[model samples]
Target: MTPTKTIVQISSILEKLFEEHFEKKVEEMEALAVSGSDRRYYRISGGGSVAIGTYNANVAENNTFFYITELFRKHKVNVPEVYKINKDRRAYLQQDLGKTSLFDLVIKDGFTDKNRKLYHAAMAQLAKAQWIAGREADFKQCFASKQFDEKAIMSDLLYFKYYFADLQNIQYDRSLLISEMELLSKDLGRVQPQTLMYRDFQSRNIMVYEGKIYFIDYQGFMQGPPQYDIASLLWQARAQLPAAWKEDLLNGYISTLNELHVPRMDEIYFRRGYVQFVLVRLLQVLGAYGFRGLLQHKAHFINSIGPALKNLEIFLADHPQTPAYPELRSLLEKMSAPDMQDKYATTRGSEQSKLTIQVSSFSYKNGIPKSAGQHGGGYVFDCRGILNPGRYATYKHLTGNDEMVRQFLERETRMPDFMNHANALVAINVEDYMARGFEHLDIAFGCTGGQHRSVYAANQMAEYLRSRYNLEVTVSHLNEKKWVLPDAAKTEE
Candidate 1:
């Protein structure tokens, strides 16, 4: 949605929330700068008080955040206080942590002793979140996957290979690369004495509120080796912390972990796992830069590719080649070469992108949408398991595009979890098709009436793919109209 449309919808909800929950009118709502995801955030103030209001369509992620906030506050983890969640679980109000992010501090102060102390404090608190709070929290409330299992690990690796490496022609021997990825995932999964992994831990996610260190953006947390979190924080590319500082902070983290009185790890074994996580984490970030910078044409992310590549180069120099991932090391070695920077620096290969995806929604009662392309490739997702919004008289004439049906399906049904899993399965094929240079792929969603669930799924998936990859995408609701293929050999529009 455009910013204007988004504001219209969000203003309505925020107005109601302020009036009903806080018994005050919203005097002002200022848009805040956000990094990733489609979540909309506003600084809301009224009656000489201020709070942050958030609106997101991803219900599963919202629920995960709400649940984790409650758990973290109960254990003294120093997260923002969640004041209220609106009905439908998509909008909420939380305590505002006063606008000073650790990133802003580093930028303004420029890496001084005081900032270093804040870093140390943040690390110590991370230990508590992992060891004490997250140790017993209900993983069942977690969104998407509960653990960073082999499947999750491999997904990260593939994300790098396809989005970053394949775009740069770095992953040369697809079969061998797959073998190395599987082995690395197995080794990571077997690491013992696991705890919560803050999957996106970084300085930007840390808030400095009233001389205290507070962590945010952790709804992506999962059960995994604790080392991943530290590796993620210390080796973040944009921070560009000095090598000596990184080494010192790493050792400091280990000491803090030991003080927790958990089972002690052999320093050697722990360091090995840390190294693996560091390598994978760097690649994962490069993949993000590729999508946001190269495909999406964002200069801020595009400029960071140089620094991120430098970080990878530094990591490789510190840790020499290992036999466990010869292919991966070779690929990274080539990518890190100072001379090859031109390929990924200013331009993306979007002009050469070959894949086009057709997404459609249909009612099973009418018939499945038939594929007309010569490639003859596609998959159908059955969304009938989702509750039918059509069953209610208010939603009978409304389609998924209508706010009422969208709210009903998202708020009242298990559509979030169902689509989460379905997207995971479809993403595998989509990436593979892109890597293989296929010209066309088809995806369709079906439900009993196709007016609500199927249409919602199809629209959401189309939006996701368009943002994720540099591919031509089109969508049509087959149940609502006749979409005749132009020819047997083609399927455009």
Candidate 2:
């Protein structure tokens, strides 16, 4: 809905609500950023305080949020307190927990110690809400689905198949995949849900204000395992928590569950359920991205697909053989392959108005990544002669993207001399390519191990090209994902 129309509706609702609840009048209301859902949010100001106003044409969803909010607030869950609901239930005003989402903070400071503490605290709160408030959340008011059973799980899988998989032309036995999904659903379904499950409990859905975490977007709350929410939070596509961080947060959640005196969740069963849910959530997210990005042409959503797929790849690599569905597991591994990634690079390929200069870094040990297309080959510059940071014990785990490696390459080597000559040569070629109307160019940097010097070179080349020319640039550290040459498909939007 348009801002003007939404404000008008909010104003009307506020007027009625004031007569019933508060004496304060709203002085101002401005539209907040739109979320993935169809809800319209506004920051309403009044009586020296601010509240959030939510509007949605779908009254059922709004009602669900409202009723759930009431239930949660009654149980002291860290959710926005609802002040008023419109008679039609199309709009409501609730407490404003501030504009900062956990995602915003994470992007600003990464996974720092403070952020880790905050994540743990949020998980504790999540555990409490699920166990304490979840049981009492008026399931009758649950929107769309009341129970996350086999049917719900199948729906999520089918969403991925139709929306995401169909776009890639992946060859797989549909019946076999479905049967596997059914089996997987049964495995997770046995978890015995005891609390309310927040269907979309990611970092973005949790607001961090005044050193406290508050929840939002619980309209899809229903009876489900707490592991699903944990998967959603830790395996969030954009947040990109490292494997270590995810494990730490998982342990924190489990500890909180134990403290809450919740049922003794068998660690073995919970871990298995968590991994399955991680896969399931990845599929659900890919479907959403495919619909919002590929079909609707939203660049951000399109950009997110790469990260989401990476999260999936990480999970698959960590567990190579899916004992349950070998065929499905192989299909997922194929989907994570560079060749498969190329098939799904529609967001950039479809927008062919500008030339895309692909700058990639690889380790010679694993071989160089293929050029983006069959447009012949491109330059492959060897950085093996340069001093290797991988030789150092401290920098072993660090990649070129890390500040330490970047600084090491600049301070401890003849990188400046190499880059100067490399830049001049590439500039000459780029100028010629631009004049000739060539659409693609690839510049690869390969070292003994792609982790260090090559990564540094690729990063520098991408930066230099972006600064010197008005060309579209894509920088991919092919070896960043453990020597696996992921697609050099990250393009500047």
Candidate 3:
């Protein structure tokens, strides 16, 4: 097919697919070529702003991408707004991400320190995306259709082996390699599972527009190793950042992880992240070189092989004690010998789960809390009475008589202080309370009479707590009999 004809065909397919879903017409279409695999990109101008359409039927279904994109947007990440999707046709319309990829920026000599700072900021945003998605159960539920467990990891490994090893005419004991891979898989499985792995997280797949990073080519997201994404960033194909910068970036990632409540994420996980980096890079290099380069004549993949190998060597030499070092080093050494060809197992059995366990502790004193506490636990601090308090008043005033009640009621009640104190107490007694948990906590507001002061205070306090703290709160008046009605004979309205 001619290039123009092919573009028309794909554009028609996309237009038809989205129109069927959203009942909209495509006003303008301009194609762009910067994506991997068989996907096609187009700028569809219509509906207020132009929408970018990504059509990749083979790698991912349309609806899946649409849903995932919406999820990312909902979690406050800057995902292109998904206008429409047709799962059957494998096409969708999204908000246009402008005409700039980080790849383009770097090529144009736009790699200023300011840009680098922006990139790190973008990385921080990526971290937030991971954090929110990782904690969600529904996010994990979405990947039920995909088998990304140990077997899948192994399958990817096998893909690498098939292309890289076979191309090099290498042969080794498959059973032994499989055995070692099985052990490696077990170790990996123990690392900690989190939702939302943007399977291809690299500079090329990120776009910089209006001083923010926009994520693209993210349909391969899954509930897998968190380190996978981090590894992808540190060992990206486009830029070879310095070790100190990488460390700083990794530290930024850790901070984001901590904010999101991922457990036990210390230096150990950092080391594990490096290991994951090597593994993923190895897989990508092998797969890209074998499938894209050898089979499809994609020169980019072929060119990447030397650099990939060099990187692998550097990583292996640096981390000699890693479990996969012996097998990898031996394989590399054999590959260097002209006559040696090695065949290795690419798949392995699922190992133990690797989720970080986080627990929070709060202290309580005399059924009230004195301070905020979280031993890796999530806590919400609410500041009440900071805003308008009159809106929360529950007791209406009497016009005449009952001056005492009016004075009492007119004085704003001060229960927020007590409630905060109560919350502090709850925090302190968290452990003890858990041992013998109480069903409810009722803090009463009382004055000279129940009518004015107590009721007003109770309302004010409730409003304050609700606005400020991340806790369930309720307000109630303990006394209300002091105030005389404006109309005694008739009931007070």
Candidate whose lDDT is highest: 1
lDDT of each: 0.79, 0.76, 0.54
User: Per-residue lDDT of 1-493 in model 3, one digit per residue for the tens?
Assistant: 2232233355677777656655667676665654244566777765554677766645334545666777778888877777766545456677777878776776576546765675677677777777775455244334334424676676667777777766775567677776776666666655665546777787777888787888877776777666677777766544655567667777777776677676665668666755764565566656766676545433355445555555555555666665454665576656634232111111110111111211111112112222222333323222233222223222234321233222222222343344445444433433233335332334443333344434444444443333222234443322223344445425744
Instruction: Select the stronger candidate by TM-score from 1 and 3.
Output: 1
Among all windows of 10 consecutive residues in model 3, the one with the lowest summed lDDT is: 341-350
Question: Which parts of model 1 are misplaced by more than 4 Å?
Answer: 1-6, 342-493
TM-score of each: 0.68, 0.68, 0.59
Model 2, range 276-346, lDDT digits (tens) per residue?
78888998999998876655444467667777888888888887654358767877887888765554443
TM-score for predicted model 2 compared with the true structure? 0.68
- For model 3, what is the C-alpha lDDT against the true structure? 0.54
Cα RMSD to the true fold for all candidates:
12.1, 17.2, 26.1
**lDDT by residue for model 1 (60-176), tens:** 999999888888888888999988888788888889999898888987988899998898888988988988887777888788788988788889889888787887755478899
